[model samples]
Target: MRALGGLWDTTRGMTVLRDAGYTPNEKHVRRTYRRLAEAGLLTKVQDRPVQYRVESGAV
Candidate 1:
């Protein structure tokens, strides 16, 4: 969650997490993103590749 918190304004992609020190694979992050989206704690932006942002005040 620290990673997400620190990236509040940035649209985070799986690759960003990997580059930012997350140890898990991209698939793991993708799954977690999906769950968060379903829970309404995050929003997924569709584009060339999907990206995510934590909901405002969700933390």
Candidate 2:
């Protein structure tokens, strides 16, 4: 999640994560975000391309 901190949303987050040397399967990344959202640690803002914001204090 620290890798995702400065990113605008998940697509950028994944790109940054990859660039930072973290490699999870694409489906796993998406699923992890979904789980985070369900747990209220993240909030989905848009569906097209799937954008999300980490909840306040989530870090």
Candidate 3:
């Protein structure tokens, strides 16, 4: 996300939001990734932890 910019896993993304006081849960994180990826706004890395990176300039 804009917080760190480039390559991050679910844990990292959740951590970033938590650190910012968003209180987003695991399901929320997964939903975000799923929605974005489904919308073609995110690219899911076929890794163990299932990382996702948002496509910049995407709606």
Candidate 4:
């Protein structure tokens, strides 16, 4: 997820994943972000665009 930068939304996340050689769609990106948030590695900051902030020490 660090490939996504400190702050990102689903669209950027998909690009990051794709660049990393992963086949990702919007659903996959959202799911991955949700999992990261649940693990405390990320925090959801917006709902419309599904923005997220990387947690401190997550890098």
Candidate 5:
């Protein structure tokens, strides 16, 4: 989704989910990102805390 369009931190996704009226916790955010990466919707950045981004120019 738009939240993962660029290099995004998982915490930021939690914030986005919260702003959208969902009470997603850290685990939910991580799971979502992992799944998206597996599904090729996101590319995972191998950082300590990890980061994910959608393909360039992708929606």
Candidate 6:
């Protein structure tokens, strides 16, 4: 989520994707993030509001 300065929650991430001309569904977005976290590309850094951090050097 470089558009979000590398840390983002679902709502903001979806907005960024929309701004970039992608109309991704919410479930798809969440699933993608889940996959990224599973793949070690992202880290779940917050619970409330559900924020995540990009792994170091992941950009």
lDDT of each: 0.64, 0.73, 0.79, 0.84, 0.79, 0.82
Off by over 4 Å in 2: 2-10
Writing each residue's lDDT as its tens digit, candidate 4 over 2-59 gives: 6546678988888877888999889988898899999999999999977999887886
Candidate 5 residue pairs that clash: none
Compose the digit string of candidate 1's lDDT tens values, residues 1-59.
63445332223455566687876666676787788889988777654466666777675
Candidate 2 worst ten-residue window by lDDT:
1-10
Cα distance off (Å), candidate 2, residue 25: 1.9
Q: Relative to the unseen true structure, what is the C-alpha lDDT of residue 36 in candidate 2, on a scale of 0 to 100?
A: 88
If the candidates were sorted by their lDDT against the true structure, best first, what order would they fall in?
4, 6, 5, 3, 2, 1
Model 6 C-alpha lDDT per residue in residues 30-55, reported as the tens digit of each score: 88888999988889998887878888
Give residue 14's error in model 5 in angstroms. Answer: 0.4
Residue 51 of model 5 has an lDDT of 84
Q: Residue-wise lDDT of candidate 5 within 1-59, one digit each (tens)?
A: 76445677778898888999999988889988888888777888767779887866455
CA RMSD, predictions in order: 4.4, 2.7, 2.0, 1.7, 2.0, 1.8
Question: The CA-based lDDT of model 3 is what?
Answer: 0.79
Q: What range of 10 consecutive residues in model 1 has the weakest lDDT sum? A: 2-11
If both were scored by lDDT, which would come out higher, candidate 4 or candidate 6?
4
Clashes by residue pair, model 3: none
lDDT of 2 by residue, 1-59 (tens): 64445434556656767998997566777887888899888888888878777777775
lDDT computed for candidate 4:
0.84
Q: Between candidates 4 and 6, which one is better according to TM-score? A: 4
TM per prediction: 0.59, 0.66, 0.73, 0.82, 0.81, 0.79
Clashes of 6: 0
**lDDT, model 6:** 0.82
User: lDDT per residue, candidate 3, 1-59, as tens digits?
Assistant: 64456766778878989898998888888888888789887788767788887687665
Greater-lDDT candidate between 1 and 4 = 4
Best by TM-score: 4
